[model samples]
Target: MKKKLLPLALAAAVLAGTMAGCGSSSAASSAAHNTAAPAASSSSSAASSTPSAENVTLNFAIWDSNQEKGLRKIADNFEAANPGIKIKINVTGWSDYWTMLEAGATGGSLPDVFWMHSNEIYRYGSNGMLLDLTDRISKSDKFKLSDYPDQLSKIYNISGKQYAVPKDYDTIGLWYNKTLFDKAGLKYPDETWTWDTLYNAAKKLTKNGVYGILTPLHNQEGFYNFIYQNNGKVISDDKKKSGYDDPATIQAMEYYTKFIREKLSPQIFGDKERAEAMENGLCAMGFFGSWNLSGFAENQYMAKNFDVTVLPQGKTRATIFNGLGNAISANTKHPEEAWRFVEYLSTKEAQEEQAKLGVAISAYNGAADLWVSSNKTFHVKSFIDMVKYAVIRPYSNKTTAWEDRAYETLKPCFTGKQTVKQACQNTAKQMNEALAAE
Candidate 1:
């Protein structure tokens, strides 16, 4: 199942650290499980089948085609081991994925296993549209939920039940074209670099048609990083209101806007055209997660000089942690088999395979080394190393709706069209209304 990349809908008013406290499902929570889950009777026949007869055909869904080759290899290995079950991947782009899922949710025809994101976890889990893996994950030594960072695991928890197992986690970083930097006589970005250093480097590199930096005023890629650096909150204590008006938040927004306002970088959004621009070397420095490393390295233009470093810091080092999760469809005809496949996907071996394929950073703790070595270009290990201090992306149910409006309404702040405080107040009001409707 695919979903739209609702960039602005998942409003984050605070640092990624704030959302770490969200998924607090303890084994002790004692209400009966929600009936929205598939009935036990449906699984009775499958469960009773001999271990050798575990044979079942399940549909697995994913959004990106970039990792298809690697994921399919993993699936082949899984089928070979089980001898009873087979998984078919139905891949689509992000937009189509969401469109199909919204339709599926209404018709009860969702795939057996599909990718999940933090923004959609609460919506699906609360509605009982996903299978709860709390029991399976807790019992399997092969799938230790605790091995992942607390914040990451928590994002999948709703009312004390684990609805999904994390597939991978990503932290933001600065990707630069080394050849471009060298030609411009500029040093590369480093762990010790701050926002100002980035700004100055971007300015010096802004010669000819090539720009220095690329960041939008949107929440995820742009302001979210700054908000944390300035020590501001994005949501209220109850999570029912906006935290954008905080001084720290205001500072963060202004900081991001400065880049666009000053024309040191391109004032572009994360559209297909902009992505193509990065691949074609229209921009020198870009902010992205470790997930894009492989593609960046493979780009004939960007690859020749591509390298990465930790994101520039402010008061402290902070980077957004974005992740994809694996969930079981609540209406699947084969719950037991689906659960088994989900379990296999979350295992250390599957994660290592994913890393080895060099598409994304795996959520499993030790699987990153394979990804680092999968590519011989530059120091890909930097992608794996940044996860130690990474912060998972902050999210809420209204994330998509409010995030878009906030981005549009506040674009002026970065472009000098409006003052930071003015934009903050307006965007906060808009986001609060969106939250209230939820």
Candidate 2:
């Protein structure tokens, strides 16, 4: 079985891009948003060859099956180049990935190297459960930290130590079914579109059992967009407060809740909601990350009929772009070999292969265009154009736990079960509690 990364994305809906919450009224605030810096112009530490007689097997886990074939290929190449170090690919669904990782962390049996998300990176790094790779990273001529976008590297740092290397990056977009739009006699969304345009288009598209949009109440993909549009933050610097109660946050929440409040969006529950929405054609548009590209492309039910565009712009055009990092367990016996695996994975060759396979967009510069062209379907080009504005997800040790509470309390606002003010205040109170507990 393929090892999997944790399903934190589906379970709590973490927003992407560091820039998402950094929007400011002044140019300075905007400029304060840090981009991922390019990798340092040096190779990582030299790969020390361990004798073949002492070969050991290491478990590498990830969450997505779409990239299994490509990763297997990568593992094969790593073995061929390294001689005897074997990386056993273990894949699991998102739900089980985190459970297993948490258990592993406690039992001291975590995989030697595993996939890490932006939200949890700080938590793991700060706890000393993950290896500090800053010195190794700086020494590696093949692993220039500056190659990645600025500020991206900062996500993995905690208390002066860096623990993970970025795996890939993804941005959010408005994924729509072309057939649904054509049937409704409406045009597809564009970069110039705004919240008014989105709502109006969704209204026109709603008829019979079909709705114009499918927006989950989860903060990452749903409400976070509105939060950024209206100018809000998820948490404060000291990580002692929640931003849910901010007036801008409330206004953004109100803006997004309109679809469900106005009965323009279908009632949905759990995973079934997403599948039913797509399979039965219940909704024309869905907001999600680029990572969903592979699943939508391979789905027989929706593959040939769908396309994506930049999400409707709010006060300013912004979308969240999140990334995963490859982290080595601090307990691993073969730190050097583990570093080799990570180094090989980050290079342009492996990344390009990933893009060409259409598993997901690669984080390497110049490899994204290959992903857009990998498939001959809808206007995939627009998805790449969105990178210029992509922002990273908020990073904190308690980000996962805090975000869950925030979403749980805010969900009522979307369904009209609670007013925006009550939801925001409750969300803030609950989120602060979670942060405090951490």
Off by over 4 Å in 1: 1-55, 236-238, 414-416
**Model 1, range 32-103, lDDT digits (tens) per residue?**
111122233332222223344545889887765445556777777666566678778776555566677889
Note the Cα lDDT for every prediction shown: 0.68, 0.68
* Candidate 2, 220-314: lDDT as tens digits: 55667667766776777676888888888788878877788787887664543454565557788887666656545555545666777888888
lDDT of the structure predicted as candidate 2: 0.68
RMSD of 2: 8.5
Q: What is the lDDT of residue 76 in candidate 1?
A: 70
Who wins the TM-score comparison? Answer: 2
In model 1, state the lDDT of residue 326: 87
